[model samples]
Target chain A: MKRRAFLLSAGGAAAGMVLLPQLARAEAGRIDWYTGSDQNILDFWTNIVQPKFEAANPGITLNLVDAGDNAGLQAIGDRAVAAMASSADPQADIFESFDPRLPKGAIEAGLYVNIKEAGLSNYSKINPLAFDGDYSVPYRGSQVLLAYDTTKLDPANAPKTFADLIAWIKANPGQFIYNRPDKGGSGGNFVRRAIYEVNGNDTSKFTVDNYSAEAADAALKPAWDLLMDLAPSLFDGGAYTAGNTPSLQLLSQSAVTMIPAWSDQALQAISTGVLPETTGLVQLSDLGLPGGFSRSVILANGVNKDAALKLADFLLTEEIQSAVLTELGGFPGVAWDYVSPELRDKYKDVIPTTIPVFPGGDWEKAINDGWYRNVAPNVVRE
Target chain B: MIIWPILSAIGRTLWLPGADGVSRFSLETYVFFFSDQYSINNLMVTLWTTGVCALLLLPICLPIALYLRFAKGRLAAYVQGLAIFPMFVPSIILSYAIIRVLGPNGTVDLLFNSVGLPKIRSPYLTPWGPVIGLVWDNIPLTVLILLSGLGAVSDQSVEAARDVGARRWAVLWHIILPRITNSILVAISFTVLGIFSAFTLPYVLGPAAPEMMGPFMQRTFRDLNDPTNAITQAVISFAFCIVFGLFYVRSVAKNRKT
Candidate 1:
């Protein structure tokens, strides 16, 4: 009798071991999100969004992975692309990109799931431009603007046109600054706008999808000439800052009067006391500034497609969009008409015009290379 | 376990099928890395910065190590504490602190102006900025290594040299330095590797065009989305480290034999 009882107990224990993992898998489903955004965005998702999401849907978990910006996105992209090539799952179900162009290549490689077909409730509220071939969902936007200290520079005398800006830079030597183009997009935006201004203020000629070296040379010759003319008049005799933050730091310390900066970042810095209250931002009237949106793409082979779609849709909700404006100081991913009046009024003057998307990968490479080779050598003093 | 992943990554760069669907072993990545002007420029910059850092650190570290070894008092302890304190501070905070103190019209400039001298522009925006930060960050480790080497030297040996009518400088030149040659090489190897693979200091302080290999490789892999070229850059960096590592090994082996 004792031997028979021991054998039955041993068989039951073995069965329990075999069934445990299956039970756990049935009980809990998890969605992994990869992002290269800053701390504020990370906090909003972790501290605010995650708990609310989990509460609404039981037995589901959301994992937020903070990757480093720009460069971090690339690392995640490479890994994800590699995993997809081997018919395996990537590290995350959702991938967040700092630049839309960063994910354009991956999307073309068919790495992302098409969330448009998921019939998300909040999809209609987003700006049409935010959709990238039905694979991406933009969450926030950053617009490039001329940020200046009001205590030093008269707002009325601020440059309105590219020509006016160049003259102002020359007149106030060592007071105006822009970062190197290859370092940050604000500087690249400044350079691209200059190229637009030189081509008879017609952005159409340069807005095509393909890159033509001959066409670029002809269109950008005058822009290079303009940059060469402005070189000697830059801050510290043409030695520019390395990145966006340094430029803002220089402005705050009264080292420089003005710099090209992201509108949302400038405001956020001011709110955090990094920039003084007297700091003001303005978009050029004659020469439009560049603006782009940050987007999220769901991987094609994600483990929990339903959860990923739900989270993406949730990020586009009015409540989250408002939080993006107030908490993170980001432009809403949805149309401005959907935003509160107070927030809309605050950014009315600095609202960015829709500029052309970056032409393509080859054009981008050429632009960065051209700036380093032809422009940086002449402008950089030491 | 670590070696397994590194070898796999390298193998992927050398043999993995590319986007064009060709899977064969090739030196194409190396050819691409060497042929690119930007990559070549970054490599040169990395070497230059590392070489300068090693040269700058030796004189500075040697004296501090010697002083700590010879001096006996609370002042030596305080100095040692000060040297080690910077290591406790995070590199990012240290970098920001350095920038604030050395930026245009910053603390240094303010001091110069207050003293009635012409206000000098800060070099923090230039290549020299990163060099200074690198030295500041690595001085503690370099000093620690040299101090360990100094411990191996005996005061009796120095006294014997003095009794033999050797001068202070001669004693230091012959007895002290020869005993610590291995230590100096070790310190130099650390500085070289630290500066070559540095990201935060150079990213915050150095110019954008001629970046260090760490940041350059990151940008190539992440921003440019070219993993093969990035791995190629990594392989080159590894080659440099290996050369210095070999020197370290040889010095250690020689010391053991002696």
Candidate 2:
């Protein structure tokens, strides 16, 4: 009799505590987001972005998938193109950190949503400089900066101009190295800036659509000469690091005093204690180093385009943008005014207010190849 | 099935899309690879690393295998264990350990400094870096193949040579060395093949430019973002590997006849 009373009271309590059962909503809206990496990128989405978006719109389910690596991401682009041509389901709704230039002219073909007119509530707050085109919705960004060891060189003495950098490199042989231009963005941007330096500060010729073999040859020859002149001063007597990480690794080991590194990665390494506390970062005053924004594109013909759009909008919202800045050491895609005041105050000194972007596409590829052929011609041992 | 990928890779190298968007036969990739000094440098580096590694493996592993074959004690077992130890360690881990030990201002340099020795010129990011790493990696397999070949020599053959006034050195040279010729061939064949196509150790330890074929192909694909060029590099690497592969096949066929 006592057990029955206890069971009845517990059942009553459970009944009282439970909310009304909602209708089954597996089919309501399952938006599959294909992010390229299963590392920090996936973690950012699954942990920070998903919970709030789903909580706000209960019926919309956020599905995370790892497309993984460049090849995998390219395949996803191809799939969208194929599905668009056949008028079938695109299968994927969202792609995070997707290269918009993939599939050649997918942007012009309307394969991706036009975010400017998509009516994202935070559209007004978007950083115009960071935004690529209507196809790309950049929510987070990072810049390449001159990362140097403070213990070895004082901030006052660190190079401020491209000319100073060259002079400093010459003065300190075997203390500076950049990765090979083709290997990583940090290295690529370093070469890009050097190209800018030698071409009489003409950033205009280097554009998203502006590239010609004749023009490149004329402009790049001087850059190559300048870089080749500086090569003998680099770490390991002109040896370049393989990538962004290796450059940093050499710095961490104190093998090199300076390198070009991504702001986010450098910050992350410093905070995570992978790099020493004495490692310092500074941007060049003249023709500042280029930075990039991570963009997410929604397929125009996605099965759950509306939900995907909503999620894209949510990524630009103040809370999420702040999270990107705090959590990933990434710059907010939204403008400084749109970011929380406390964060603005915290990062104003370290974060460049106007992050300059280098031209990508054909120009980047040409520069990388030309760099290999011209500048580092003597990389082979005798 | 294996041949299909190789054929496709070769096909990709020869067949390319023109600026006119018409598919046609082309030798542009090959022309570029052979004529371009940078590409040729990369090829030469690959060849150098393979040749050096294959050459080094015989000298490094033969002595340990010869000792293990005749010695009857726990010390031989320990020597065998030490020689084969690298086979268990992953290449990536080995590369890092090598970097730590041989990199600039690393353990060796620090120890040398403490003892008032001149600084060691680190080989961490030079052509010789991959050579050191590859030679260490191939030791186990080379020794094992050598030991098996030494097994055929028969102690009586060695003892008979010794009885005929042959010293230990003479017995080793005349009896042991002659008997293991096939094994040495087989070991060299395997070593050449493995070193020819190796990627990880070379990619990590080797220099940025003049990279090995494995890293060269990958850098062309992923970094240069030229899949076609990468495939061309692969086809060329395959051509070199095939030459070494033929030696293995011929030796095996010869052994079968015997």
Candidate 3:
């Protein structure tokens, strides 16, 4: 597959020279893009957004590469592809905002052209939380949520807090399960929520500016102890864990009563009829849903700066955002009010009004602290 | 291409897990490697699998090699080809076949339970699954070596030993075995290194917790951004390769030294 792409790239580059003069006049040129979308989302991009963007720009090509799963994109980081279509900051003209973890130092080092200075069309419409007059803007905000089977769990008897959830699990053994947080993003987010509830949500101490090493450990102690106590009643005696896919599989099988689900998964389930349409959504009272502002970034060093900028402007447009958020499962980076009514209706109730941002200056510390690492495994042992 | 990558991987592996230095001057990775139980546990699993695989392969290969070596004509040629056939199938296919044959609901399990015998727990979840696969993989090479070496032993010498009033067991053990000693050493040394660096069999077939060093390397490089640890694992894996590589080289070179 890689070899085929290379051959096509070579062929396209040759064709590009012959088309360059014609492209400048009446203008049909290709704009290469890289995105971490699946086939369904890719179809939406190709069949829907690409045609619209190309029709508007006329004679412009939009070459997109699906960057694959989260881990694959993370492994390459933003720098490795900064020169390719996948690069956030290609060496030539384009810049994109797909990576939220764009290192502040790398951007400050002038690695990416600040989109704020680039004068994109309708920059004002972007949410301030996502577009901070900086190197990138957020395209979506996803959260981890708790869901229950409508048939087995009564809405009136639903657990409201971490303590309530645990007590319910104890009362009904083998009735609840969540994917392992270390293996799945939703599980990790759920674990973080548990830590916050136990620590009274004072995770600010773990930030670089105020990180007291002892305080971090102390905060996680109770959460760890609780997890150790709850391990046995977990699904498969806490031995078998599923990622989001398997967690959802278990839910669909009715093998589990409760599980931690990504907001998008729950929304997808409800939309597709895999989950009951009447399912209720709630945050733990003590710990609000763990949320993070998803940021997309442009590479400081990219190959085609002009084409990349054009692609970025195109993606940031309402047309693409509406089509993407509606078809793919997630909230858009634009404000809630700005979304099309059709898209809003599909997700408004499902998407949380508020999301927790990983407090600045190093979230890794907060995530890796003893509370999460030392105590999380006890979930299977009970 | 695979050989170059494996060799380059060996150089890359020399650097320990925690060492982040650009220049060559640190043993911090070694210290970190030894401090962790995960590393030690995986290494022990590799050794145990190697031992079990060697034990299972030796007896089966020896007699078959002996039959092919001394047996005359068409039968000998057919036996030689049939004996070497196991090496033709890739190790992964062999393992999958074993899983189907020995899995919980597989033929072996059904057979045992039908006879009122205790249900045989599968080795798939244990190091033994990989051990079995590796043993099956090495059988052909071991068989060929034993067969050819037995063929080279003079028929006249065996007949003379038997005629001198020596018992059948005594004549066979004393005269026949000594002639094939080099071939046995060569097979053992070569098979040891091959199994030591094996990754796929264990990765596809082994249990989760007590994973071999190979799977642990995959998780470190791709899942965890801890390249230092990945490099450390690659290094230890090469250390196994080198130790076994040197032994094989020495055994081969012993012929020149003689």
Candidate 4:
């Protein structure tokens, strides 16, 4: 009996040793990640993605650091951070910057790694025009849409066009509010959309391929004039202007009624009870598209290039994309037709089917010359 | 090595490229600042705000310092302690507290609302707030310096003035003013330098486009990452500060010689 007990104990010790390495692999080594996500994203990645990635790919741990926003992401470029994530286009890697003029810099600086070489260049999955020459990927796309508080103004009274919106502001003094273009992406997108509607000969004429100095100004003139005219009806009766977040704050506090907001921003606010549940989002009938789109890029020389590409690819997967669309307020980059039925039912109505017109490469140069000089001075700097 | 970088930045700031490798030195930045009219307006506002603070500080500080020197009571010690108390508080905490009082929705706004008036917008955000906060923080040192000067007044001089049939007003004017003129100059010099290098109070309180050297320097370094412009601005500010410092030192030396 004593010999049998000893043999059983020895057998158990050998079994423990056999299982230990496998268990350790399941918990993986840490892979540092940087993202310009709010606390919600921080929580989502930690609770959901981190554990799942760790479990599926043994010895792979994702340690995420919150960079908060674009400015914070830019700060990482100024630092020795492992990776960066932003909503701006590919000026830096694992981030976002919209300046189309910067693609050359990324290529020249070797700050970009072609995902095509990584066996993840599934370009056919995304909209043809949205695909870059192996530089950036559309992470989550949304357009600037008109949002209104139902309690203050009924749908019947809502403005349908930029012209209608301007007229309404005149009719009802001190009603419309938006942040300055420099302050927030959604706010800047809204202003730029106004420029597009007022300037472009047709929607297709607004593409990067078709951009010219004359087209920019001609499209921008009407919007510029309208904003200058409506400057009086804005906050402080045009005496002061709030930036994007503050403008949203004004909308939330019932200080203003009609404003432009991102689709996800509107949904995020409504879901969290930060905004009224009765809020409505609509695309302009005349413009067809919403406002703008965001892109994501990979750093060429990051600490974990392979892992970052894997994560980027995983994020683009139909399942993960669907989850992002349905669970998160973000719109999926994959075409609506390719979306799963579960995701389709959940987010089809909430996300706009219409693609927004983004400013081609000339957007930055035009803004620097036109709006900064002409528009900024008229409004109070606040 | 540091000097080379600073000089390079200054050279780049001053010289603009043309067709060839050679460039022309032009004060385009300074010209731009002046052309906007903000530079003069901001300077005037900064001075006026600092002036008001100095005026208010003068009477409150003088009496407390004098009492600390002449009086023998516990109250004198307490007064001296209280006069320099602002120096002990962290500058950020001090600035934040002022914001609470002067902000649009601050306590002062409540007072305005009670009278059916609009909320008071802060002068700080306009360029005045920082000057006011800076002077409040600076008054302690000013008082301490003045008090030390007053203490150095000899007992013999007072007796001599009394024996020579000098009236209180006459003695204060002729003897006290001349004797402490150097201290007064020192305080003024310190105040000028203090306001010149100031970043935080103005930063928290000033408007979007602050005209002072502080905000300009900050923007160049942080947002622009154009260290050349930042170094150039610093060098210019330093030049002006050095002139004032030299004048102050000369005045103090001249007074001692007399």
Best model per lDDT: 2
Pairwise TM-score winner, candidates 2 and 4: 2
For candidate 2, lDDT tens digit of each residue in A44-146?
Answer: 8888888989899989988888887767877978978998999977678888887787879898878999888988988888888787777889899899988
lDDT string, candidate 2, B1-258, tens digits: 999999888887787887898878989888988898899988998998888888788878888898898898899889989999999999988888887788877789889989999888888878898899999989999999998998898878888888889987888788888888888989998999899889888877787777788987886787569999899988888888888889889988988999
Q: What DockQ do the predictions score, one after another? A: 0.37, 0.32, 0.07, 0.06
Error of 3 at A71 (Å): 13
**What is candidate 3's local distance difference test score?**
0.65
Q: Write the per-residue lDDT of candidate 3 for residues A1-382, one digit (tens) a residue.
A: 9999999999999999999844432122554455565576567677887888878886567776566865545444444434333433332233222444443345556666687888877567776645544777666656777777778888778887677988998888877766545557676677777767777666554454655546656766776676657766765454334256556655665656888887766777777887776566555665556765455565545444566667667776787777656565666777777788876775544456556544433344445334234543323232
Clashes of each: 0, 0, 42, 11
| Model 4 lDDT tens row, A209-243 | 66677866767767778667777676445522224
Distance from true location, Cα of A289 in model 4, Å: 10
What TM-score quantifies how close candidate 1 is to the native fold? 0.76
- Interface RMSD in Å per candidate, to 1 decimal? 2.3, 1.9, 6.5, 5.1
Q: Distance from true position, residue A7, model 4, in Å?
A: 58
- Per-model TM values vs. the true structure: 0.76, 0.85, 0.61, 0.63
Q: Tell me model 1's lDDT, rounded to 2 decimals.
A: 0.80
lDDT of 3 by residue, B75-134 (tens): 888887777787889876776677667644467877887999986766653567788788
Off by over 4 Å in 4: A1-48, A63-137, A141-160, A168-180, A183-187, A200-225, A237-310, A313-372, A378-382, B1-10, B24-107, B110-118, B121-258
In what order do the candidates fall by lDDT, top score first?
2, 1, 3, 4
Please estimate how well model 4 matches the true structure, expressed as its whole-model Cα lDDT.
0.63
